[model samples]
Target: MQRLATALQIEHDASLRTLNTFGLPAVARTLVRIDSARAVRRVVDHPEYGRAPKLVLGGGSNMVFTRDVSPVVLKVEVRGRRLVEERPDAWIVEAGAGENWHDFVAWTLAQGWPGLENLALIPGTVGAAPVQNIGAYGIELKDRFESLSTVDLVTGRSVTLDARTCAFGYRDSVFKQEGFGGLAGKSVITHVRFRLPRPWQPVLGYLELERRMHETGNFAPDAQTVFGWVCDIRRGKLPDPSDVGNAGSFFKNPVVTVEQCRDIIGRDPAVVHYPMPDGSVKLAAGWLIDACGWKGKSVGRAGVYEKQALVLVNRGGASGAEVVTLARAIQESVYGRFGIRLEPEPVIV
Candidate 1:
């Protein structure tokens, strides 16, 4: 029998293990694939599923499911990309929310706009980028963002929001917020626009990129070179999701005040940290985890990635509950030693 909820097709008892990078076993009670702005509205107007709780899923790279999902899952698959505008100072490009983030970055460079090169090879969708405020190798999504369009769940109205309204911060945005003016679980992003600056300047101050420069004797590299370098660096550090089931960085680097930083440095001078412009310091979560001797360690079927302590991998057939157990253990150990609690990066379901 053909199952239809108005214009939307619903999948019952949908397997989510294949959708998420962690590859944990779970099922979505109801699932719908959204490919356009109208499709999102259809979901909002549906009779039964409309008012029920909904979960907007992107690339599923940053999600961990601990149990069968009860909320309706709207898997965004909207697609398209094009050059929007070219001004003297910048070239504006746009892409559908569902576009693969890494692919879009590569596509922008191919089209001769090169500002997104440093962010190459990051997993997840373009829609998820702004939500996570994704960053890498000295560049962040906000660094090249212009604006994005979203469909409100209640009103079914499409609105365009700028960076200010998005309230982008370290791995966070209004999309992840839930107080007054928060958009979390309230809207679905349909399209995203990027303000790629006209004159491409390679962002190469990052340690790994700098080391690459020193090794290659190339003080100045093009966008493609930087892209290659970032891909190589990430490949060496992070295990591919295909080979190992794991979400990318499991925790956000804890930011501390100058006094706290000094105290930590006093206790452990070898701690890896980055000083921010605001005078606070960001300590590497991976370094803290490794210091606690958690790398390559496991709790049941879940374990820390042998290559990067910041990542939790499914050794094989691991349950999401086991993964959470492993994460908590790491957090407890790190807090015991450094007196700092690590916040997870992925959305735990």
Candidate 2:
């Protein structure tokens, strides 16, 4: 390994205001830019930081920094993308952990790959995608995930993990857990591989896509069309982080038992819900927040989005505390009415 001092770009007291999508005020006491797996190994072996607590940060799209960071920040910037292999059954594609998730999806489609169209325009980096098991519309990252390479934070050893080992759940993976065998805060992902099957079939029938098809009179939309529609729909519903400081979706839709769903529906007949295959019902958190009269509501410069109640936006110069306050208020209201606790989607740092 190269000398740790020579192989890394280390910064002190770095401003993280712009790094996070929420634009929350925070500073990293020591921030290190890691461009490769070797660089991460260097960080692990370096005497000055090897034993210290560290935080791995990607595009910061899925984070809300509440205060100045104390742990050594590993800003992963490893970059690469390629077709690893092609077979009769599937195409193996790979991307550096640092690549933008949305851009990578578009690149895959441009190269004639179509499996990732349903996930286009989601925020954050490819490395972060597996950590969250990100999903949108009718597809989740785990559906196409093959494997990922991660470097141990303590030993500098690299290991590749597949979907089964990842233990994916709703917007979750092993990387998001720290109990028992969880890899959370223990390793840094350097690259990811995806398995895109051949003889592509578009994943349609999603409510928004169905609406687009109905309006356009084009029922058989291609991958590009699906990608375009997703992008357009996202633009219309979610606030762009650049224009308004906000993480895309602030809360995950709460899942409930069939009996619980019936109880809530009895209270509010218009409650929007979907019956999951597992016999559970997924309630729309945005609708719940809106029903609680939180839409366009503000608490100390942090507010629920008027256009989409699922999002909490920084109304300009908002602190992370204020955002959390607003989120808690919304959560309490939803729980009081529906008896379900709404869980936040972003990682609060």
lDDT of 1 at 239: 87
TM value for model 2: 0.98
* Model 2 pairs whose backbones collide: none
| Per-residue lDDT value at 80 in model 1 | 98
Which pairs in model 1 have colliding backbones? none
Once fitted onto the true fold, the runs of candidate 1 whose alpha carbons sit more than 4 angstroms away are: 1-5
TM-score of every prediction relative to native: 0.98, 0.98
Lowest lDDT sum, 10 consecutive residues, model 1, at: 1-10
TM-score of 1: 0.98
Best by lDDT: 1
Candidate 2 lDDT over residue span 150-262, tens digit each: 99998899999989999999988999898689888899999999999988888886899999999999998889999999999999989989989998899999899999989
Q: How many residue pairs clash in each candidate?
A: 0, 0
